[model samples]
Target: MSVDLQTVKRVARLARIAVSEEDAERMTGELNAILGFVEQLNEVDVSGVEPMTSVTPMEMKKRQDIVTDGNKAADIVANAPATEENFFLVPKVVE
Candidate 1:
């Protein structure tokens, strides 16, 4: 897949990037080179290779799922500017 000057110009327009004719010409070559490299990579055979998230092997740190806070309703409601019966009251915006 080769990138042409028009394709580069269209890509720049889609990305909302300002590209001069000279810059567009440069980008056309750069994009074509990247596509050529990707085409080369497509020729490699990796049928049995397994997908991995990282190169190094390590176990993730685990933590016990437990609720630490128990019944702090009064403490939370105290900080509210307008609170009524363990609930924060706000101005009614919708009619």
Candidate 2:
């Protein structure tokens, strides 16, 4: 419900931020204010609100989910030193 100087210093130390005593004192009030605003938000009635991906009403753009050979298999293997069936041929390194 509130932030104190010690909590601010501990948080700063954990975050690896260099904060002087004065800055820590200042952040104490700022953090408390932010937390207070968040607490206020918790009191709002939202049981009727539906979960949505966006604020504006719009349908999600979709495409057909289908599998197809990209058709560029031949083009992709064109520059290979050796290829078979549109696949790269590599030398077998293992005996």
Candidate 3:
């Protein structure tokens, strides 16, 4: 999968990035290099290798799944700029 200048320009446009003609050419080369590296990686064999989140094997910490408000309603309301009867007051848009 070789990338050309036009392809690079299209990719830049799709990603909402502004690229000059010279920069587009450079980016095209870089993209081709990355794709070449990916192709090289694809040639390697990994039949029995297990997928891992980290290189070092370690158990993830577990916690109880409890849902609560933590009893801080007054403190939360004190920080609000405008509150009315336990609710934040905002400008009504719809009639």
Q: Which candidate is the best by TM-score?
A: 1
TM-score list, all predictions = 0.46, 0.45, 0.45
Cα-based lDDT at residue 75, candidate 1: 95
Clashes found in each candidate (C-alpha, N, C closer than 3 A): 0, 0, 0
Question: Per-residue lDDT tens digits of candidate 2, residues 19-72?
Answer: 999999999999998998899877888998877779888889887898656879
1 versus 3: better TM-score goes to: 1
Q: Which ten contiguous residues of candidate 2 have the minimum total lDDT?
A: 62-71
Clashing pairs in 1: none
lDDT of each: 0.91, 0.91, 0.86
lDDT of 2 at 55: 86
- Looking at model 2, residue 80 earns an lDDT score of 95
Candidate 3, residues 28-85, lDDT tens digits: the string is 8899999987887677798998777798878898878887457777777888899987
In candidate 3, the residue pairs with backbone N, CA or C atoms under 3 Å apart (3 or more residues apart, or in different chains) clash, namely none
